[model samples]
Structures are given as structure tokens and as C-alpha cells.
Target chain A: MDVSFLFGQFLGGLTTAMFLFLIASGLSLVFGVMRVLNFAHGSFYMIGAYLAWQAMQWLEPTLHRFWLAALVAALGVALLGAVIERVLLRHLYGREELYQLLFTYALVLILGDAAKAIWGTQQLSVSRPPLLAGGLDILGTTLPTYNLFIMLIGPAIAVAAWLLLTRSNAGRLVRAAALDREMLGALGANVGAIYTGMFVVSSFLAGLAGALVTPIQSIVPGMDVEIIVEAFIVVVIGGLGSFWGTFWGSVIYGQVLSFGILVFPSFSIFSVFALMAVILIVRPWGLFGRPIR
Target chain B: MSRCRILAAACLAACLAPFAAGAESTIKIGFPMPLSGPAAVYGAPVTKGAEMAVQEINAHGGVLGHKLELLERDSKASADEAVRLARELIIKDNVDFLVGTLTSAEAPAVSTIAKENRIVFIAPTSKSVQLTSPKNLHPYLFRLASNTDIEGHSAASIIAGWKEVKRVAIIAPDYAYGRDAVAAFIGYLKKARPDIQIVDQQWPKLGQSDFTPFITAQMGTHPDAIFCDVYGGDFVTFAKQAGPLGYFKAVNNRLVDGGEVGTTDEAQALGADYPYGIWSDAYDPVIWAGDEPPEHKAFIEHLKAFTHEKYGSGWAIMGYSAIVALTDAIKKANSTDSDKVSKSLLGLTFDTPVGKRTFNAKTHETEMGEFWGQMVKGEHYPFAIISNPKYLAVGPFTD
Candidate 1:
């Protein structure tokens, strides 16, 4: 009930918001351009964390090597996404949405099992970077330095994403593809290449988010299911294709969860569903999403 | 040797092969445990231990002129699956005995089927109090592993002895095992320290990934010690999330936990994130080393080699012990009849990898307790080590 406690809770919520935004933005981007509902997005995130840890271990495992390994691991997932887009998703684009959904869901099961086979069920933890290992005093409460880094990364990526969408020529093509892919194809645009690029970029974002949180989270099998469920909620709450929508949605959700735990400890999980239900009732397509054709 | 006669003779030989194999006589055990789920980390090692024990026993010329055969099935850590497999193992395989269930949820279902069919059931690692309690107790059901009551008391005894501890908090999974573990710990804790005040309690749903809310809530109450019963993947998540919030380092507020938290596997996995100086109970190799029987040392070595240095947790020991006890009961009865073996299992004493264990006649629960110690990184262990180890006896209430 004190000011400092409230401030601390708000910061904790911000940390959650940052990670949610980092993950949900990628999912929203994919849905916007490709019209494919990727249920296996969480698998990419999980693999990013595992591969990052593996990469760091293979390297010196020093604090200096961690950030570089994380970047490379995320790139690895991006490369994988590109291959998947070329080999599998390209063929499925002409099919019904339900079939696409089923395919992605199948991928979820296959990827989850593959991860278990590779990593085993034992939980793996990544050590905090030595520089950000401890806490810093903010007012009367202490906050972890690593948490602050994650919070900053969220908005920094948001700005970078905004610029990429608004300023870049590829961004214009992406917006056009979201509106009408047939017209863009008729206009002599390589629609296939654009879709692949979008998928790769989105997967990279997801992988980056996963790698960023690895230092604080214990990477384990089945984590993909846990995260993907939450990511779906975030994307749904935000408009599916809206960038700023995801940012706001994550922030709102994070605050609600943080405060809900304090006010209603048992019902905190229900709070998220309640908010989503209300949004669905009022704006079925989400706050910023366009009506489905 | 006409072609027609040779073909007929081949057919006859093939038909009689099954009968001859049946005549040879083999003791079969239906081993159902979580082999392909989140619980497999614990269950797989147990399966390995049971396999090794059976192999060793069979190599020494079997149990009473019958080769030991294990019919292993994946229970998937579900009660429904366990019950289904129990029926299949019995009706389909026609096994002589049932053993090896991982979780408490699977324990009762398997035991019920075992009782109804008059088959002997031995649970290697299910530790919920309800499994062995009189309410669910059946004549054919026996447990070789220590239950929650013993573990809780062992944890409480250690916590009570901590000189600076005055207030306590509790956190566990929101299920049967978690609730019972906390209750048992609190009951013994209150008895030990009558003046101790319980400040807070948190029961996060099992498999909860985010512990920030729970951590913040627990920190608000400001207890001197927190007793946690969360294990497996959830434990790792809690440790990672809570460590940053200074949950482990808050002055005079130590953390006490039951089962598998500070073991070598966890310590190696967590690396620098492992909470040093926290008190926990583990079935650890370091605890087994130094001064123990030669057989215990040999069992440890064998398990390490067999697992290829992958698993050597207490679950392995439990699995190894279950087979030892079952074989011992059969040896004592000197027969393969389920009813006779079940009767012999009552008040049966047997040598295990850990030590000599006896099943109490009334409860059908073993005298297995827990090994309690403080987590430390020392020269003796490459990973997390239990520096000071002590074994507590399973009291009357454990069953």
C-alpha cells in the first residue's frame, strides 16, 4: 500500500510488458503479412534460448561472449524460418485458413518433441552477465539491472520497428501485401519473397526476445506451450496486424497482472481472460485491427 | 526326409515354441512410470535403475529358478493412463507383479487395480500421504520410497534447529502433494518451535513460469524462513525468478525445501544461479559417499556408469530399492504366487542400495526417510554439494 511498494510492482509489470511486446510484435507482424497463424512461434523462442546457451557454452562462456552468442542464435532461428517459409509455408498459402492452422499446430507438436529429444527434460539456466548481475537502488526499492536492460530493449525495438515499417520501401510492399496480395502480384511484385522476408524478420524478433530472457529464465522443455499461450493472448488483445496495438496491449496486460496478484492473488489469471472477453465483445477484430473480409 | 514331413515338423516346432518358453518359467514385473513427459526427468532414471537391478538379479541365476522380465509402460504421469496401463499389464501381459509409478496421482489408480486383481503393487517414488494412508491403503499395496510426512518432518527438524529462524513462510504447488507437504511441515514446525509465527503462504499453480507475483507477495510478509515444496521444472523457474529479487539473500530469512532442489543435477544445471547456503533434502551421491556400506558404494558406481554420468539422483535409488524389496519378498516367500508374496512383503526387511529397509506390517510403507543437508560448493563435489548430511528416520506418521 506504500508508494515505494507500488513503484516496485509497476516496474515488475513493466519487465513483463517488455518481454510480452518483444514476443507479440513478431507474431502480429507474421499474421499481418502472411495470413498464416503460426502456433509454433513459441517453439522458435524456446530453440533460441537453448541454442544461445549451447553457443555460449561452446564459446568461452565468459560474460563478454553471451550477447554475441544470443544474437547468432536468434539469427539461426531466422534462417530456419526462411527455410520453412520456402519449403512448407509457401505451398500452403493457397489453401484454406483452417488447414494452415492445423499445419502450424502440427508443427508445434513436432518441434516440441524435437526440442525435448535434443535438450532432454532437465532445466538449463544461463548465468546473468557479470556487469548486470546485481541490483541498483531506484528510490527506496532495489531493481535488478538485467530487468532494466530488458525494459529499455522493448521500446528501442519498438522505435526501430516503427522506422522500418514507415521509412523503408520493403515496408510499403509489406503494407500493400497485407491489404491485397493479388494486386501486388499483378503489379509485378515478388509476393513470395516478401512473405519469406516477413516470416524471417518476425521469427528473428521472437528469437531475440527468447534470447534476451534466457539469463533470467530457466530454459526447459514445455516452456514453448506456456509462452505461446500468453503470446496469443497479447496478440489477440492487440490488433493482429497493428504494431503500436501490441505495444499498448502488452503494457496494459503487464500492469493488470502485476496489480491483480496484489489485489486478488487467486484470480489474477482470470483477469487476463476477463479483459480479453470484454475486448472480444466490444471489438471482435481488436482495437486497431481491420474487419475481416 | 520327405518335403511334406519336413514342412509339417517345422509347423509343429513353431507351435510348441511358445509352450516350451512358458514352461521355462519367468517372473514378470509390470513397470509403469512417466517415461515421456515432464516427469520423465525423474522417472527415466528410475526406469534405468529398475532395469539394472533386474539385470543384476537375473544374471545371478534369477529369483527362485525364474528369470526376471520387466514389462515397462509409459504412464505419462496421468491417473487415467496409469489405470489403463495397469489393466493392460495385468490382463494382456499376465504379469506376476506391478511396480514403478512416479507421481502420487498415478499411485492410487495403480494400487486400486492391483488390489482388485490380487496383484502385488510396489510404488518406487510416489510420496503423497494419501497413497499410504489408511483411507486408501490396500493389502497388496506397498511403498518403498519415503512419503511426504517423512520429508516434511526432516525439513522441519532442520529448520527448527536454525538459531536465527523465528518467522516462516510457505510456498508449494497448488495440488495434493503441495498442500500435504506444507501441512506436514507446518505441523512438525509448530510442534518444534511453538513460538514460530507463519507470516505468509503461496500456492502457485503447478508449472507456473512467472514467479514475480508470488515473490513480491512473499517478500511483503518478510518471514525469516520460507519452506518450499516446488520441484522439477517449476523449481528451476522459481529459483531464477526469485534469486534476482533477493529472495535468497534477505538477512536471517533462509529457504528450506523438500526433495530434489539442491541435488548435483540441479546445481550443475543452475550453475551460478543456485542459491547457496539454503537448506534442502536430496538423494545425492555426495551424501551417499564417505562412510557407507560397500554395496552402497558399489551401487552408486554402477548407476553412474550405467547412466553414463547422466543421472544419479535419489529416484534411481528408489527404483533400485523397489526391485530389491520385491525380489526379497519373493525370496522370502520362496514362491511366485501374488498372495504369498504380498503376505511376505509385510514386515519384510531387505538390503537396498541406500541401506537396510523394512516395510511396516500395518501401513505397508517402508522405513525410508530422507537425507537432509545444507547446499554448498566444496572441493569434494564438482557440482552443488550437500556439506553436512544426516539421515532422519521415518516416524509412525509417515505412512
Candidate 2:
């Protein structure tokens, strides 16, 4: 009820929103350009987390750099995404969207099992970098420094993505491809290369989100399912391929979930679905999503 | 015979091998557990425990002149899958006994099928008090783990001993297990220390990756102690987020959590960040360090060698106990008939790695024990170990 309490809740919501945005944005970007809903995006995120944990084990002693490990993990997932897109996803582009969905869904199962086989069935965590291990006092509330760092990452990524999509020649090609892939191909835009790039970037975002969250949340095998569900919720609410839509959708979702718990502790889990149902009823395409081409 | 006919006959023979083996007077127990997924942390060890027990029983010339056979199935931690697997095990596999449904829901779902089909069901690590409550009790259903009441009271009894503690905050997942655990703890805590006031109650949704809201909300109330039931990955998240937020550092505030938070897995998950001095409870504690019965020692050692680890998971002990209870019940009845085994299991005594346990005939619930101790940095163990473990018996409060 008080200012401090409200401020605390807002911060919590914002922190949650940041991670949601990072994951959903990648999903939305891939869906926009490729028109393929990657169910394995969450698995990519999970793989990212596991990769970071493994990297930390090797690097922490020698490099002592959490940031470097996170970067390496994200890039590693990008490479994996590139390989998947080249070998599997590229071959199925002209097929029915259902085939694409099933393919990615299979990846979720395979990758999840792979992670289990590699990491074993135990929750693992990475420590917060020494510089950001504690909290910062703001308006008499102790906000975790790591949370603030995560919160800042969302906007930084948003800005970077905006620049990449709008300001660069590569961005133009990607957008052109998203708008009309057949035309882009006819115009000699090398659409295949653009698709591969988009997938890599998308996977990098998912992986970055996973690596960033390692210090805050326990990394576990089934975590992919938990996060992917929420990411889908964000993607659905934001509109399938709209960039800005994802940003606002994540904000709405995060705030609703955080504040909803305080008001309706027993029903907070349902609030997201309720909101989704309402949104679907009014706007089936989502808030920022364009009608299917 | 023609070449095609020869190949077909060989394929037919390979397909029927398991059925032929089953016909050879073996008692089959269907073991359904979450061998994968998030719950696998608990389920995997539990499966190991059941397998260990089966091996030991078989080594000892088997039960009732029948070689014990374990047919393992992955429940995937879904209640529907557990029920489906139970049906397959019962109708298709023709298993005589059902063992190891890990979660609170999976246990009852499979138990209902077992009850209706008149097959003996043994739950290894189900902690929900409702499973063995009078309303849910049936002739076919039996559990060999400490129910929520036992753990809650055990936790409460220890909290009551802290004379300096006054106000307590409760944080648990918003589910049957969590709500029931908090309720049982409060019921017993109120009885033990009437003066203590519950200031805040925070129920986060299960698998919630972030606990900042709950932690911050609970911290605002400024209770002297916090009682948390968040376990596994969620517990690790809560500890990591709350540890740096000064939730455990405030003056005169202590933290006590259920057993899952104190396991070697949790400790290993958190590493140096694992908070010390917090009182924690476990289903299996490291209490047999100096002197343990040879059977208990052997069980622990074999499980460690089998699991290839030093720390013995409580779920492993519970899993072992479940089979031990089932085999002992069958021995007592001198028959594998469901009715006879069920009747014999009532008030049946069995020796487990934990200690001697008795199944109450009325509740169909066994009086197993849990160990309570403080988490401290151990020289001999990884992460933190539960120090000064004292065994607490199940029953009394929930009954």
C-alpha cells in the first residue's frame, strides 16, 4: 500500500520483465523473419544456462570472469542455432508451419535429454560476479544489484536490436525478408544467409537471457519447459513478430504477475492466462502483431 | 523352414522373452517414478533406493521363494502419466506390486488404480499428509515416508526450543504440499509455543524462478525467524536471491526449512553461497557417522557405491524402505495375495537404514523418522552438512 512497498513490487516486476523480454524478443524475431514458431527457443535458453555453468567451471579458476563465460555461452548457442538452421530448419522452410513446429518441439525433447545426460539431474547455480553480488538501497528498499543489472540488460538489448534492425544494411535485408521473403529472394538479397543470421541472433538472445539468469535462478533440466511456456505467453500477448509489441507485452506480463500475487496469491498463476484469453478475444493477432500475411 | 519363416520365428522368440521370464514364478513390482524432468532430482535417487532394495532382497534368496523383479517406468512426474503407467503395469505387465510414485499427486493417482484393481501399492517418498489420512486410507494403499505432519511437527518442535524467537514468517509454494506443510507446522508450532505470532505468509507458485517479491515482502514484516518449504531448484533460487538481500542477515532473524533445502544436491547447487547456521530437516540425515548397525551401514555404503556419491539422499532411504516394507509384509502374510499383504502391512515392523518403523494399521501410514540439524560448512563434505542431527518420529500431530 505504501510507496516503498509499491516501489519494491515494481522493481521485482521490472526485473522479471527484463528476462521475459530478452527471451520473447528472440522468439518474436525468428517468427517474424522466418514465420516459424520455434518451440525450442526455450531449450536454447536452457542450453545456454548449462553451457554457462560448464564454462564457469572451466573459466572461473583461470579467467575468473563471469561476463566472459556468459558471452562464450551465448555465442556457443548461436553456433548451435546456425548449425540447426542450416541443416534442419533450412530444408523445411517451404513446408507447412506444422512441420516446423513439430521439428522444434522435437529439439526441445532431444536437447532436454541431452542436457540431462550431460549435467545430470541436479539443480546448478552460478555465483553473482563479485562486483554485483549484493544490493543497492533505493527509496529505503534494498534492490538486489544483480536484479538491477538484469533490468538494465533488457533496455540495452532492445536498443541494440532496434539499431541492428533499423540502422544497418543487414537490418534492412532482414526486415525486407520478413516483409516479403519471396520478393527479397527475387531481388537477390541472399535470403538464406539472412535467415541463418536471424536465427543465430535469435538464439544468441535466448542464450544471453539464460546465461544472465544463471546467477539469480537455479539452472535445472525442466527449467526449459517452465520458461518456454512464459516466453510463449509473452510472444502471444505481444503479437507473433512485432518487436516493440514484445517489449510492452513483457512489461504488462511482468507487472501483472508480480503485483497480481500480492492481491491474489492463490490466483496469480491464472492471471496471465486470463489476460491472454481477454487479449485473444479482443485481438486474436496480439497487441503488436500484424494479421497473418 | 524357408529363410523368411526362420527370421520371423527368431523375432517372435525375442519378443516373448520377457513374458517367458515373467512366467517363471517371479514377483513383479511396477516402479513408476519421475526419472526425468525437474522432479527427477528426488525421483532418480528414489528409483535407485528401490533397485538397491530389490538387489539386496534377491541376494538373500528372495521373498517367499519368488525372485523380486522391478519393472521401472518413467512417470515424467505427471499424475496422468502415472495413472497411465499404473494401468499398463497392472493390465499389461500383470505386476503384483506397485512401488515408487515420487510426487504428492502421482502417489495417490497410482494408489487409486491399485486400490480398485486390488493390487498392493507402496509409496516411497510421498510427503503429503492427505495420502495416508483417514479419508484417503484404503486396504491396498501404504506409504513408507514421513508425512507432512511428522516433518512439520519435527520442524516446529525445534523452532519452539529457540526461546529468543517470537514472530515467524512462512514461505512455501502455493500448492497442496506447501499449504499442507505450512498448516501442519503452524498447527504444531502454535501448540508448542503459544506466544509465538505468525506475522507473514508468502505462497509463491511452484517453479517460480524468482523469489525476490516473496522474500522482500516477508522481510518487510521483520519476523524473528522464517519458515520456508520451497525445495529443489526453487529453494536454491530463494537462497541465492535472499542471501544477498539481507533476509538471513537481519538482527535476531533465523531461517528453518524443510529437508530438501539441506540435501547435498542443494548444498552443491549453492556451493559457498549455501547459508550456514540455518536449521534444516532431512528425511535421511548423516547421523550414522560413528556407529551404525551393519545392515544400516551396508545399505548406506552400497547406495553410495551404487549412486557413486558420499551423501545419501533421503529419497533413497525412503525408496529402500518402501520395498523393505513391501517384502516384509509379504513375508509376514506368507502369501503374495493383495488382501493378505495389505492386512499384514498394517502395524508391520521393518528395519530400515533410518531405524525401526511401524505401519499404523488405522492410517496405513508408517511411522518413519526425519533428521533435523543446522547447516554448517563441513570439512569432510561438499557445500554444507546438517550438524547435530536428531531423529524425530512421524505421527501424533497429524493424527
Candidate 3:
């Protein structure tokens, strides 16, 4: 492929990678702190996308109102995550992870039917709030402003979380729990409250991830199934429970999708799997995975 | 009155009403369609249309003194569900005629059930060629909808006409529809345009939301065009993502089909800028969108009348057309008997918004050709309009 065309594919991969990061990061944070896979992370992402679209439609004033709406929509989804955790997920805390998976999967079915009942099985879209709809001309291709915004947001969230985790006191507790739950419990950290708080935070992150991608991809019923598959692939490739590892995994996946096809068209779809195989074979714990202490 | 006497009278009335309804009865038509699942988009329109046919038939003083009562159950597009529902419709609902099933998978299952029950089975949605092909086990089956053979020829011919088209990529939902559409499109295109290379062919499952990796892979090969047989939300999501990713713009042309253009609900999911140069078959509202080319005026009027009298437009009309066939067979037979109706339906022809739809006696496939359209700015329709339509019959379909 030529330079410009290759770059276009790279950009495409990067944009996709950003969403993967959002999903994987949330999934990782939950596992890192609470040791749950949050199989319904995809559902949260789906719900957030729908809710974000709904919120914007409800608040439709003008073109410029969208950026603010997008932010608020993310916040709104974060609140939804909090609610979901408090009401439903909290009950699963004392149970085994298998039960949690089943519960969340059940929630996926319920939420999907609920979404269909409320929204109908119609394909829904939210216009780019007018202001961000236009594209930037790059090497004769029009790159959507919304996509660029999404890619930018991935690193921004990653950095922000890193800072919060390292610099803040809550981050200390999170690290403490990540190190050893038994020790933290003995230290009188009110482990149950911390775990609940962790679940809410993880759900919020997943919701935010969904809200971020709405402008890039359309929201429809069953969006969760697709999004979750990609998220699972990323999380596995990056090594489970490693926050920053998700960052690298997304980029690697994006690049694989971009360059794999260029090199070999027929086998390209299997490219991500090939890389994952190599990663697992070479470093089964993932490039950055830490043993559970 | 004593309780026993009152109960006896009420039971007698209840028993006699169905018997009375049955004695003066029209054929009890039964249907099980995916009224709630992914296939519901097609099933809903089809059911509504068939019901309208039953209504019109019953309005004309019942067929041979029997008023038609339509019975329906939602199959949700699963073969298992369709079979279960079909059994219930046949055994309990006591339907004399059976219809429905949007998925080809469910089509034969229901048909087999109908065959065992000896009910005339007419599928309004299932377009799998094997349905009535003598090879199919159920000889009692018939469908008035065009099959994939005609679609393949039409699609191949459509691609041949495009100037910038060279290498064509195929992506379809990996099922009967997908497999058939790819086979037909490729077969015809190879025959029509030997120079045009058939590039990558990919099939994703139905209800799949992510097409990025698939689309990205196709884009990498840098094919001249992409043709998709994906429908419903699958089409909508693909279009929305593909449109923004410049997947359409990068190619010389793109073709999206599988019954999406007829409805606005899913079309709205693709947003305003639907592909302009792409070719897709649908009963386009464009005739109402008004460039008023030739007989389109009368056609538009007929379409509006039919739609208003049936469904607003699109699948509603398609469904209505299918029902028209079923009801017409019953009318001609002048009986509610399945054997009689089935015999009459053989070698049947009728006028519809989709043009003259006739079924072949041997194949039981509709002979009406498919229409292909180009996108244009139409006043009435929100999305692009389909202008140049093709009428290719079941001639090219062998399987």
C-alpha cells in the first residue's frame, strides 16, 4: 500500500483501538481491584451509547451543544453504572465469579429486551451535534472529527486514571486491595465498601467507554455482543488485570487489523489471533500481567 | 336459572359459535412469523399484508360462504420456534392454510410440519430456492416471492453497468440468503464481466454488529467495490460505520441489499447520507419521491393507495402482495380446502406494486423480476432514491 492509503488504514485502526482501550481499561480496573471479569461490560457500553444518544436528543438546542452533551452523556452513563452496581452487582460480590458472570449475562438479556421494548428494534443515530460533523481533509481523505476526538480521548482517560491511581489516596487503597485483599481487610479498610465502590467505578468506566464511541459508531440493540467480543480480545491480548497493558493491546490490535490485511488478505482476519497466540506462548501472563500476589 | 343449566347453555353457545363460524367459514389461514426477533422487520410487514388480504377476501361476502379468520403466532425466526408454532397453529388453531417464516431455515421446517398436517404452505418471506424445487422434501410448499437466482443475475448485470467497477468484494450474512446472494452475484458477474475480478468474499453471522475488521480487511485489498447482502440493523450499522470510515468513498461503488430500503426505521439508522451510487432492490418510495419519470405517476398513485390501504409503504406492500397471491388462490379455488387452494395457486399470476408476480408451477418460485435503483434526492423519501430498476425473473436461478 502507498503511504497515504497505509496511513488511512492506520488511522482507522487507531480509532478502533481507542474504543477497545476504553472497554478493556474498564474491564481491567474491575479485575484489578475486585477480581471480576464483568462479562456484561459490553451491556454497560451498549446502555451508555443508547442513553447518550437519548440524552443529546432530549437536550437538543443547537450544533455547539453536542460537545457539552457528549461530556454530560458520559457522566450520565457513569451514574447509570453506579446505579446498576449498587442495585444489582452488589449482591454478586460475596458470590463466586461464575455466578456473577451468569447474573450479568442474564442482565444482558433483560437489558436487551428492555431496550427493545423501550426503543423498539429500530436503528438509532444521533447527528454529530452539527459542530463536530465535518471532517478534516488529510492527504485527500476526509477524516471525521468525531473519530479524531475519540482517539484523543483514549490517551486522555488513560493518563487521567494513571494520575488518579498513583497520586490519590483512593488509588493507594485500590493498590492495597490489588496487592492482597486479606491484608487490606486485616488493616481495617472496610473491604466490602471498597469492593462496592470499585464495582461502581468499573461500571462507570465501561459506560463512559460506550458514550465515547457513540459518535463514531451507531447504537442499536445487540451492539453489546459485538463490542464485547472486541473488548475480550483486547483484554486477553494485553494480559488480564493490567491497566496500562490494555493501552498497548488496543494499539497492537488496531495495527494488526490495519497491516495484516495489507500483507495477506485471506489470512488477515486471523491476524489478531496469530498475534494473541504468539503473545500467550511467549508471555502467558501477558506483556505486563502481574501474578495475583 | 340453576347453575348447571346456565353453564350448559353457555358451553353450547361457545361450542356452536366456532361450529357456526366454521359452517359459514372461510379458510382458516395460519401464520408463524418472526414478529419480535431480528427477522420481525420482514415478518411484521408480511403478516399485516396477509391479514389485509384475508380482510378483503372476507369483505367480499366470504370465500364460498366461508369467512376467513387469520390465526398468527410469533416464531421469533428460529427453526425450532417456527416448527413449534406451526404445530400449534395446525393442531389447535385449526388453520386450513399455513404461511409465514422470514428465514429460509425456518421455512422448510414449517413446510414439513404443514405437509404432515396436509395444509397448503405458502411462504411469504422465505426465499431459499430449495423450498419448492422438486429436491425439497415438501411438495406442498409454494412461495410467491422472487428467489435468489433472479437476484444474482440482476446484481451481476448491475455491477457490469457501473463504469469504475473492477474488483468486487462480497460480504453477506452467512446464511441461506448470504450464501445465495454471493453465489448468484458472483456467478452472473463472472459471466457478464470476465475482466472484473471477484475479490474477497466474507460472510458474517446475522445480528452481528461489528463489521470493522471485516470492512478493514476488504478495504486493505483495495477492491473497486463492495456488495453486501446484509439486511435490517446489520445493514444499517454497516452503512453507518462504512460511510464514515470512507469505505464507500474509497470504492468506485457499493451494493447493499436484503430488504432494507423499503423501511425508514432501519434506514434512519444509516443516517441521512445513504450511498448514492450503490445498487439495491426495494419497492422504492422514490416514485412518490417524485422525479415523476413516465408512468411513475400512476404507479406512485397506485403505490400510495395500496400502502395506505395496507401498510404505509415498502415491506407492508410486499407483504400485501404475498397475501394477495394466497387470497387470490383461495378465491379462484372457491374453497377453504388446502388441496384445492394449493392446486389453484399453481401457475398463479397477479399484479402488485412490485409489478407482475407469477409463480412457476414446477419450482413454486415467483417469476417477478427484481428491481435495482440508483440513489437520488427525492422529496418524499428521506434517503436516496432507487431510479434504474431491473426486472430479472427466476430464469437465472437453478438451485
> What are the chain B TM-scores of all models?
0.92, 0.94, 0.86
Docking level for model 2:
medium
Q: What ranking emerges by TM-score with the best candidate at the front? A: 2, 1, 3
Kindly list the per-residue Cα lDDT of model 1 for residues A203-274, writing each as its tens digit: 898888878778877787777878888888887888787888888888888888877777666455767788
Worst 10 residues of 3 chain B by lDDT: B283-292
Retained true contacts (fraction), each candidate: 0.38, 0.62, 0.27
Q: After superposition, how far is residue A62 of candidate 2 from its true place, in Å?
A: 3.8
Clashing pairs in 3: B25-B66, B26-B66, B26-B67, B149-B397, B374-B387, B376-B385
The DockQ-derived docking category for candidate 3 is: acceptable
Candidate 2 local distance difference test against the native: 0.85
On TM-score, the leading prediction is: 2
For candidate 3, what is the recovered fraction of reference interface contacts?
0.27
lDDT of 1 at B342: 94
Candidate 3: residue B316 lDDT (0-100): 54
Judging by DockQ against the true structure, name the best candidate: 2
> What digit string (tens of lDDT, one per residue) describes model 3 on residues B1-399?
699999999999998887786666456777788776456656766676667666766778766676777787888878999999889888887788877887889988888898888888877766666666676745568876667766666667766777777888877777777787678777777777778997787665676544665675676677887677877767766676676667877774566464545344444455575656666776434344324444434544554465563224345555566667777887798777788878888888876654566777877767455555655544565655556454444345233
List, residue by residue over A117-170, the lDDT tens digit for candidate 2. 999898899988888987889987888888888888898888899998999999
Please provide TM-scores, in order, for all candidate models, with all chains considered together: 0.92, 0.94, 0.84
Show model 1 residue runs off by greater than 4 Å: A266-268, A277-293, B1-24, B285-290, B393-399
